[model samples]
Target: MKKINKLILMVMITATAVISSCQKLDMPPTNIFTPDIIFGSEAGVKSFLATIYRALPIEDFKYRPDQGFKVGANDWENFYNSASVTGEQVGPFGGMDIGGGFGYWPYKDIRNVNTLIEELPKYANKLGEAKVKSLLGEAHFLRAYFYFGLAKRYGGVPILTEVQDPGAPLESLQVHRDKEEATWDFIGAELDLGYQMMDETNETGRANKYVAAALKSRAMLYAGSIAKYGSVNFVDGLARAQGIVGIPADKANQYFTKAFDAAKLLDGHYSLYDKNSDKVQNYIDLFLKGDSPENIFIKQYSIVSGSAHSWDATMSPRYMTANALSRSYPTLDFVQRWGALSVTNTDGTPKRFNNRAELMEGLEPRLLATVYFPGATLRGLTFDMQRGIYPSFSGTAAAEVAKQPNTRSYILAGDTKTLYQGKMVIGFTGPWTGGDELTRTGFYVRKYVDAAKPIATVDLNRSEQPWIDLRYAEVLLNKAEAAMELGNASDALTAINLIRVRAGATVYNSIDIDKIRNERGMELAFENHYYWDLKRWRNADLVLNNTRFKGLMPYYVFSENKYIFLAEPELMQRNYNFDKRFYYEPIPGGELGKNPNLYPNNPNY
Candidate 1:
């Protein structure tokens, strides 16, 4: 209930003695709780803080990138996650529709945070000085988090540090947008204050000193990136001239240094999750294990609290779920980013494998752990990801790859239940063209799906996996990127190799910006970072220009009783297009209507 309700802290205390004594109402309502009553005790403060935490704008399991963040249970299409739009996965959707965001405006949430930071200090005597400062620090961290969310979507939003008085002149309450660099500076300053005032440790999922630092590491990296690359992809207009939608190129190193310094603060405070000796299992457990050392800040979910998501239900295959089935599938293009797949022979012919799972052999354990390749098992059932049965095959993979699915020489099955020669033509977890719930890319996301949960019983809103909002892995990536940009190649190499070692992949002896970017893409895949990463790096338009993500279609040859994988365009044939104008999302039309001062909107709306 706390997650759903905004705890305003004004409650009827029902002062019975006062009510009995007063025949006529001469004083303020006795039922009302004052700011002191709310901030004076730990319980009261925690209760109030719960609302702010609930509205923290984390794009977790429930976030639909094509939609906006935090649309919640109503987002039945959430499985079409941010990865879909970024070419990381091929979800059952068309082109880039979310270029203009779903209008995420969180100034109201910011005001609540401001209210806490402003009013809490008055009760310092009631709640000890240290406690009051810590609470205020938490408030600052929250405000920074909210601001970062805004800064990423629309460049420079109105920087409202103090809560605006509703009774004041309308002109006074109506604020104009701050310079993009100024907004980013404000976020950095808030996080700095947060780090200075907060203690080292706090409860899980709440902001501590290091949590603020972790956020700073991420936010400042975005700022640094925008400053460096913002000019590369520019939209000329009044907003650009006014410095409201873009950062100056000269400020790049300043922000990158800030990011680097902030990231360095988290070095020894936390370590990567390395519980298991088996790298693949260890990587898988990094997300599932609740007490992982790598998790810096996580938004927890509990079935008992009724605040759970449908990750397992939406990400797992149709055969593995009782209700909702898989909608998002990893693309071959994204999978190849980690390393080349062994799907083809030296002569460019499709490699014949004894089993579908053998395709995973010699691949990086991290990749295997991130995606459920064909023949991977969940609960007890194999993924069984066969696209269709090929009755006969005698050609190079290139020739086969050239032919369309319908035009190809394979026997297409209507569904998994369709049989050919007494054997199921399509696998249970399928690339069945007949249905939408089946796997379209021959892979299911393995990262956050709880294999411990029984697939026969898996359903929506029952998944209890906590969403790791900030992790040491991302901080390391931030460090690596910043270090590389700052020309500190050695530090960047060390940071990347640290992740590469844990991933069981070949450690790189050399580091470059592209390497760092690729490593970030591979490490933070499907965690809702790639899309934003592309935008900040000013690569979305170039990377996604008429791009159609490919899918690894595993076809079983009935004659040889062996599987041959073919890289082909995804079935939907959806083309991902990111225009230069989409580099900055348009400010929500409603916001502009409410406050004309918020214009001129970002580039082309």
Candidate 2:
């Protein structure tokens, strides 16, 4: 059998953390640090924990729906992100189907965390009992996190807590799947242990008592949702019979209670960021500011540390960025969910405006913060998003909706050089006649884009804004959803209104499940929550069933000398379809072959 020290080195080498590039760590020889050397001191233990934090399955900006968590640093696949799969945005790639995940099996990382939990107690004398317990609590939080990632994807994965010996018999090594209910119960229990054992505060990115509870608030909400809605997309299979892929609908309230209680524990610990009186700017700064009180937990990055992302370059308008233009454009369908845009008249004729930017007047400030309308400024450049020049139009707005390109009377500009009456027909930053790198929806994403970053410097691997994983807003949303589910409408209304008050939107006078859900969607838009929220609510299939998301097109009326916005199907006319079987991703085929006990796979694999 190999020495435990050898196994420790193997795990340490795979450690990746957001604090710094795992590859650029200035460390001595790996073989020098054994289990004793690693767990003996506070600094050594921190180094070990860094690796565990690095392995967390955070679906941040790097996550691609067609792929999985943590795409390659250089891969431009971040362009096709989770927002596109949902109705949040229409991207250049990846329609509705996100096939059987990216074969994510993190048991090896789980074992490393397990090894720390199992072995750390031996050095309690050197690192005081309180310190040891605290570290162990962090380890438990990590283990629960890894399992949560699996539970959300492939339901009821094997609950492997102990570090199993490799020399054990094959039958002992191959564990059978737990019931889906038991899996969520285990996750809650582990989080409870973390909540009880950890401290109230720690470093920004590190887990603490409140952070553990915050995760419980999020994770238990997911479990409660699965219990209530898992039957909506049920399939008759051995896995269902064994309780591997579906939860009992009867236990939904029990899980909702847990979610509500977990969320309540964080009531006084964090707050919604409200530094700026300007609601729009306050909302924008909430994501950008690292020191905001709203942040429960975040994944830190630094360009100097060589851990950076391409969000700014990929999301910025073509004219705003020097490299890598916009790929995903928000849909008008999603924009309308917040509230109706004032772009149509009472008779259904398209509303004509002297300035195209006036289309956003009297709209929610939160919506304005989330997206850049035609005249919104970024990096000193106004986003001039004009699609075509219509010489004349005598018909209603309904007639122009989703009309074929070649047949429309509107003279669409073929290129940037096309001129109508000595002025460029299409804006430099375009919803142009044809091409990528332009906003097809006549808008751009303003959320999370660093307005302070110089326009010329925006490129791949240049963005270093920290990804806020858990925030106080989400906790409140979770509490609100649970309260609504538990029939406490007053509490639900209060929680929902807190977010709305901060957002400068109209607060609800009454509450229901749909209202609670819509607030969650609007509040958490493009943070990569909508897709999962839809899945847990079992509404993805109904929402995306042959759905063709619409885009807002701005047309310059050449004869009238004004602009009119038209709601039209996106240029590609791509149809997004969601099969019901996608609710739970299929168990990885490789894992099933390795251990037959892991069968039967999820429905319709």
Candidate 3:
């Protein structure tokens, strides 16, 4: 069966708007569908629904910290994301300052969804009652999804349930922000409504009952964390009074229970994708294959319809990529946490490895799947990432030669001692700071890259890999985390072990909050969950205060015929001071200027 091409609908609708906007608003274009005409037909309603889907804040391939979601015609070079901010990974050149404010006020999208909800019922004659209600359910889900995005980032925002008139009094339009608790409750209620009204099966890329439940699972988990872990001390007097940013601690369990229950609803419907015999390959295949049972909700992309991303071009290693270079470099700090092959020895002591290769011998399969270390192969080529080789010398000469610059090239044992040979042999995947394409942290990203795409050619549109928005693995982790927080160890271990077993890791007999958090970090690295996870757990300030993320320098020793790894602070100075006030992003200055009612903005704005 052919895949449902939603991008075609999106293109048609966007084209219509572009043409209509170019002409005068007072005079309707010669041949165009106005808002009224568009909503009057069932096909037109689906077209509008396509627009709503396109505007979702999935934070997929186009997302960057500097620019928000779905950025078009922006420089792809400045592609740093939440992973960079959280110290899970560093950029190719150096560490980036996490200063860009998250100005994600999707009020416009919410308004569009509100307009759809208001109009869908009116066309019940043209579209059947069931179809109208399902569409309305999707609209509610979209609104809840947008509000949830806002509430997570900037606390409570104004909830506009119905479409407001442009000519209405400014005071009436300037709706007060709801309490953080109420906003979360509203999201949960809307998801419940969506789940009830949505069909069990619908068109691909559209939200069904399972999708609604998956969203509810994530939303409730965020709400539960905020209620339990967020600080009440930062609550501003005016903002608190206006119902903007504080949730009582007592309400934690209620939200956690909701998250757990919602997640439970998808128990048998989805399972971890473990089709490949090679565990590492299995983890990699999970992202490449579009029809995995683990994927609950996905944002589909189509190269044929001119809707695609540059993720492959932007993230592949320098040697592998065609135009853009690798941007996200996994950090040494994150790599160490992946843990050695065995956590403990038979005597219950921490396990240790004699050599660098031994250290990497039995790592959790997920770590290998997620990161491309020095010797990993990609697209049929091995990444020989040698910072510098240790020169072969006698006792006194060896000590002097060892003092040479580690970033410079040296002759290898098997190669000829010619100038050209030495230069060509070294720094294949560099730790050199002189260029834009070199890997400064001695690593390249492996996750979310399309290995099937042409690595040597710069074709952005051909990068049609689907972005998995809500995967069942995340839901399972969510269930485990909530269960752990609620002190249900049995349930927590049950959920977590399923993930561990799938990844070919040793299952835990006992687990703590730290174990769960680390597991989540390892499993979901570079998937855009760690940054928010740190914030919601209230550990961002402690973990990232005035710290420099670390990197590994792997150098091959010619005499020993083995590789040696040096773990040290990254060459570039990266000072990351996470101010407590950053827990809630400041309300956008433009929004505040438009409506002073959003006054007394989030603390420390």
Candidate 4:
């Protein structure tokens, strides 16, 4: 059997949590695929394709790019010192670094699927035919997803059906990347094929009519925004959003209807995992459990006892021994963005909150599932954070920091250290005197990681595999979004309320387009949807960098290291409202290297 690169994969995923690279880790093999080795048997096909779902960097919550994604004010400045770009800035794009060694390489997975699509006919009517068809749908859905990623990141990418040869010269590469419009069209069409071929009754995590509908809704949303908001480099690119029109308004409504219907089909089939049903129940526990209804498709992981990528272990805080050396410390601004005090109302609206106690005073149950503050008393423990107990480190740990001078002593704050915008709890301050940074910087991410699993020596099992990537909730949100755009606010309300009530968040919330947007933002925070959400709405620069960036978290600062939000006023100038150019990313360098012909760069680059 081929062994998975569990260690390397874990490392790659770990990098994202440590540093906000929202792209999920993509793993692919170099060998050309053949039906004989791929779909010939259930085991062969299973092993070959399972990795696509498994390799997704979802369990690691830091950069899962959902609506709640955040970049610190100073941290964004840091990113800026690293790159070069123009136009309206998104939260992370000031100097967001790309062209890195690792990225979510969708083409790699698609190549495998394309190979099957091209060769699967040989087994027509074979016993494996059923499985092949299902697998084929999975392949196309995955390919659509990859292209979705491509379209979102670079505004459109080359859609390669077959795997590229490593030795193929650049000139012989023949295919040029598609424009955003053509690619979205191809992606939407491919997803239609996948949905047409899929078994809707399959596992919740598996793709079905619901998943495709959800994807289409997302694609349409992106297309509409980009078409409406044309930017530099393209003379007539404003017409690219024509794809949205291609999928007829009624067509979109039908797809959305199926998505909602499928989700409703799974209703009661899966209930929200609300253990203890208490506001204090840990958030990480949900993801740690395998196959919860909330999870649409999942990837399995374990600590030392069983096999799992280090998605959970690596992101845990320093106080948890497992994470000290390998911490996924969150930026203070991110913690603040998470809002210990309060979240948007059940209808997805935000209200001002100052402290964790106020947030916990009378918060809904679902909001508590993801984050917790020190003042929020639970289990009679009060989950307090002692400021002096955290760590401090002064070395080359932050060697390449773009704008700020690095290294200094950091003592823990009660909870203020990581998100000093003002809160009750204190986590790890720095790498210093008795300070444990991993947990210190990150107060809590209880979305995954099962604490119920009897603690083993080093690893915890009995925990369910992480349904890491896609979820049914997302489908419902997708349905709501499309319904709203299609002018059916009432239908949008129905979809949004279903998710809200599940989280115990639907008390006084209203149902409207703006309300649904906020609800989606809160419900899908950290699930890796924010960048695209911002892009689809054309609000990346507005929300990501402007009103959201709270600058360097100073609560953890000690007398030793000197750090402060330098341009606090400049950093504070966030644009909560969005801009046009913020909708698309520039084409990548490597692909540009391959074909400067079809892949004209988005001027934002």
**Number of the predicted model whose TM-score against the real structure is largest:** 2
Task: Count clashing pairs, candidate 3.
Answer: 0
**Candidate 4 global TM-score:** 0.64
TM-score of each prediction: 0.94, 0.96, 0.87, 0.64
Cα shift from native, residue 193, model 4 (Å): 1.9
Which stretches of model 1 miss by more than 4 angstroms? 1-32, 71-76, 404-407
TM-score ranking from best candidate downward: 2, 1, 3, 4
lDDT of 3 by residue, 190-291 (tens): 999899999876764467888889889899999899888884564456666655787888999999999999999889988899898899889999987677
Count residue pairs with overlapping backbones in model 2: 1
Global lDDT scores for all candidate models = 0.82, 0.82, 0.71, 0.45
Model 2 reaches what TM-score against the true structure?
A: 0.96
> Model 1: how far is 141 from its true place, Å?
0.9
Per-residue error for 372 in candidate 4, Å, reads 2.5
Model 1, total clashes: 0
- The model with the greater TM-score, 1 or 2, is 2
- Is candidate 2 or 4 superior in TM-score? 2
- The residue ranges of model 3 lying beyond 4 angstroms of the native Cα positions read 1-12, 15-32, 75-78, 92-96, 232-237, 241-243, 340-359, 392-425, 458-461
Among these predictions, the greatest lDDT belongs to 2
| Per-residue error (Å), model 3, residue 49 | 0.7
